[model samples]
Target: MKQIALDIGLTPEPTLAGFLAGRNAEAVQHVRLWAESATRSPVPSYVWGPEGTGKTHLLRAARQALQSQGRVVGWLDTDTPLRTPFDERWDAVLLDDVHRYGPEHQHMAFNWFVNAVSPLHGKPRAVLAAGRLPPADLPVRDDLRTRLGWGHVFELHPLAEGDMRAVLRQSADARGVFLSDEVMGFVLGRFSRDLGSLMQLLDKLDRYALQTQRAITIPLIKSMLENE
Candidate 1:
């Protein structure tokens, strides 16, 4: 099989460790449950949700768990060309950012789907991620859209305040910084109610902390946020 190189550029590859460390308990539990079900049936699974809702995190976690079981896994980006060859012996496949793959790419994705689901020698299981529901709802071929929905689907919801706080604290701890509840509340109260934005804020704070060599405190966070 000829491997195609999808132009992912400098985008960071998803990691189970980082995702698990940042994810909330509910999301973790849901992914674990899905993994259990997937092992028994070994059918395609779909996960969708709003941006910053941790859809990618769950997908990556599931991929890692399956890999640890010695299952062969392949990843495809719907937005890009199918750069990676499909391993007939693969136990699973993960397609991320499916919405980004438009009509032209849909042709390739459709072909990949046929190959993946084919009853050949050793076809791999599959999992797909998207920002919306059915593929038809997206700008994809009707056949591809129908094929995408032919599996179990899970939609990850946004994090609650407590969950968000937990994630912030965990991320801070991972960076060897102490974040007081006061600081956490101050940051959350002022920032957008989304993990992505919160994460961006945390990144800035971390950089600031490094530069100043100071602990993450409410005053320091305020100063940083204000400066930005």
Candidate 2:
């Protein structure tokens, strides 16, 4: 039988204010400044780190910040089919998961990087990109890789256990639920430790709590896990 799964609970919007900068405080600050700066620099900013290190979070935060400021931004990722080259009307371009781009995506990324840095008309547009590896280590074309390293390059670090705990508690609070120390410890030990995974788990718990009219507890989590 084909089973359907429905998404439940509200996923918090990714924002700079919500980002928990543990070891990557400098990276977070740099992205914030770049997004908020009135003087647009041609030089692009790129962040590289392992999976689940908040690379996408920072990129999305920057996008939201720019859009809130009324800047037209073009966003692309490895999955986007770029049949046409990048347009110049955008005030900025955001590229996410650059390291996962295949050959055609690589071509598009290179073209977009060039156009963003040296547009034929007007000053250059700000370019922000994130990937899983450093520019030099990226498995992409030489030109695209070179452009990725041309400007500010930052490497993100994973959050500590203490920081992760704070994030989980804050998120639970936002969802109007209380996560006790025991539940927190169980979730941390029983599930994937990555922040993204933890957030998804919390969402599931939130939905289960709402559905059963019960507070999130160790027994609730155990039942949820058993059913899964």
Q: Pick the candidate with the highest lDDT.
A: 2
| C-alpha lDDT of residue 225 in model 1 | 65
lDDT per residue, candidate 2, 1-228, as tens digits?
A: 323334543666677888899999999999989998998687889998888888887998899998899998988897687666688789999999998998888888888888888888788899999999999999999989988999999999888889989989988887779999999998888788887788889988888777677889999998888888
Q: What TM-score would each prediction reach against the true structure?
A: 0.73, 0.90
Q: Tell me the deviation in Å of residue 186 in model 2.
A: 1.1
Error of 2 at 49 (Å): 1.3
lDDT of model 2, residue 211: 69
User: Candidate 1: where are CA atoms >4 Å away?
Assistant: 1-30, 33-40, 78-82, 134-136, 222-228
Task: Please give the RMSD to the true structure for each candidate, in Å.
Answer: 7.7, 3.0
lDDT of 1 by residue, 1-228 (tens): 323323332123344555643334554665566555545344566667677777665676677777777776666675444455556776655677777776656666676677777646653455554555555576667887777788766666787788788877777776567788898988888778777777777777777776666778888887776877
**Clashing residue pairs, candidate 2?**
none
